[model samples]
Target: MNEVMDYKFVSKETTVNEMIRGKMRNIKVITIGVLEESTGIVYPHPISEFIKRQYEFYGKSL
Candidate 1:
């Protein structure tokens, strides 16, 4: 059987200089990083447009 878990988020206030900022530039690069450290299945990208087109036709979601 599967188990469900609940999580709580704790946050604090801080200044911009105290925080670090960066960007991956691409999600593919991040995924490659994860693969380097772990073992898992990964799907090839450039997925079909059918799902996207359907979503747009009906309504786009967040």
Candidate 2:
């Protein structure tokens, strides 16, 4: 028999920096959740529209 376990997805983010020309710059980061089931493993799931909209409300940019 196969046992099923519930998995919880935790979302996290970090700022990435790079130096170009002579100044440092930050880049935007995006992420998505992955799904796995008895059928197959999905590399990624669609990003949430709500999350995308939240970016617009941010007080500052990375």
Candidate 3:
């Protein structure tokens, strides 16, 4: 989502918001619904935690 949102980071027709709506939203579904059920990874955490980690990573990129 951050990459898609950045004009310089990635040049694409879709905005970050559009990618969030069209693509990124399913990340939680896939993580919690399928991957967790199969692999038992900790990615099944709360969405807020994921957003926090994204912001943390983005902060590092800056």
| Angstrom error at residue 13, model 2 | 10
Point out the worst 10-residue segment of candidate 1 by lDDT.
28-37
Q: What is the C-alpha local distance difference test score of candidate 1? A: 0.28
Best by TM-score: 2
TM-score to native of every candidate shown: 0.22, 0.29, 0.20
Model 3 agreement with the true structure over 1-62: per-residue lDDT tens digits: 45333322111121122255457532221222113323333333354346546775565311
TM-score of 2: 0.29
In terms of lDDT, which candidate is strongest?
2
When 1 and 2 are scored with lDDT, the better candidate is 2
- The per-prediction tally of clashing pairs is 0, 0, 0
Instruction: Please give the lDDT score at residue 16 for candidate 1.
Output: 25
Residues 1-62, candidate 1, lDDT per residue (tens digit)? 22212222222222222221563332111111111113233332232234434664576511
Clashes of 2: 0
lDDT of 3 at 61: 17
User: Stretches of candidate 2 above 4 Å error?
Assistant: 1-28, 37-40, 43-47, 59-62
- Which window of 10 residues has the lowest lDDT sum in candidate 2? 1-10
